[model samples]
Target: MTRRPTQLLLATLVLTVTVGGCSNQNHTEAPPPSGSPPAPPTTQGQFTLPPVSPITPTSANAAPTGIPPAVAPPQVDAAPFNDPLRVTTAWMRQFCQTDFMEPINENLSRAATYATPAATAADITRGDTTQSYQQMQQQKLATRCDQVEASINPEAPATPSMVYVQVSAARTQLADGRPFQRLPLASTRRVVRGGDGRWLVDSAVDAG
Candidate 1:
């Protein structure tokens, strides 16, 4: 009867150990399967931006490389008519020629280039007397036989821009090479600086 009681107690102990082992296996975590992908990580409140390219700086007035600069045109020199005495002498030689062979209007036109508008008008009016005198000489001689010789004398002026000139002219017979007129004609001329910075004959008046 004592052996039966000990065997019953041992049976109860084995049943309790088996039940505890099954409960522990139910609560424990299971391992992942072989070759399966891992779970993704959490990324709350975080972001990544794409990369940006760098910019090159340039100037507004800078010329581009590998091109040549433009070349400037060559400049021309202007005619010089700066002197007072030189222009005055040139004017007299051009205007006072007593050539009946050359056209008088052509001579006057060339002379007007060296004078102002007022001076040019005055010179044209004076040319009428010269034309009449030349006609009279041509009728009397019946050939081109007379020429006028001129003498120029300049007086000191009040200003650098103005000059007073005295002209003495004589009519000579080209055939005999002697004075044809008894008295030499006298005249006064005024030369002044023009607006364009060149010297010009401004006026001429017969002297008494």
Candidate 2:
């Protein structure tokens, strides 16, 4: 049966291979000394190579002379991915919950995590695709928020603060209608150190 491309991609991603010696036999017949005469030809003009010793027969139908072991080179220590200024998911959550924008914020700091500049630009350009439907949902959410906030006072330190944010897909929805159900969305984020010795978010991806 034919396998899926995604399965192949996943297998490639997970495999950790190392370069090592092969099992093929190679006769390292030393060449004639530099600038020396060429080797003499044998019968029928065929330059014959030295013979490899045949293995002795054993009682158990195995060779008495075992096959040469494949040698592995000395392993070296690998370097680490040691970047201190890395972004954390907590930072994205904090920013999302605290920041308030009615229409859409296209210039937010979350656009950098993409592997290419085009993808980063797309994340920004596509921000407003769901703005209309979100406006309608926002009103309902606002009412729910008011009721919830009134029932649970914010002044008390023990009270948990809950923020509501709706994330949608690629297609745009009307201000009073529902969004499409099956639009693909993905996000990746990374933090790198700033000049001031602090970790700052440097990259974000909305799609793979």
Q: Which candidate leads the pack in lDDT?
A: 1
lDDT of 1 at 131: 63
Report how far off residue 202 is in candidate 1 (Å): 0.9
Top-scoring candidate (TM-score): 1
Per-residue lDDT tens digits for candidate 2, residues 55-111, read 354432232222122122212312111221112222222223211233344223332
**Candidate 1 backbone collisions, by pair:** none
Q: What number of clashing residue pairs does each candidate have, in the order they appear?
A: 0, 10
Supply the global lDDT for candidate 1.
0.49
TM-score of 2: 0.25
| lDDT (Cα, 0-100) at 134 in candidate 2 | 58
- lDDT for 183 in candidate 1 is 23
lDDT (0 to 1) per candidate: 0.49, 0.30
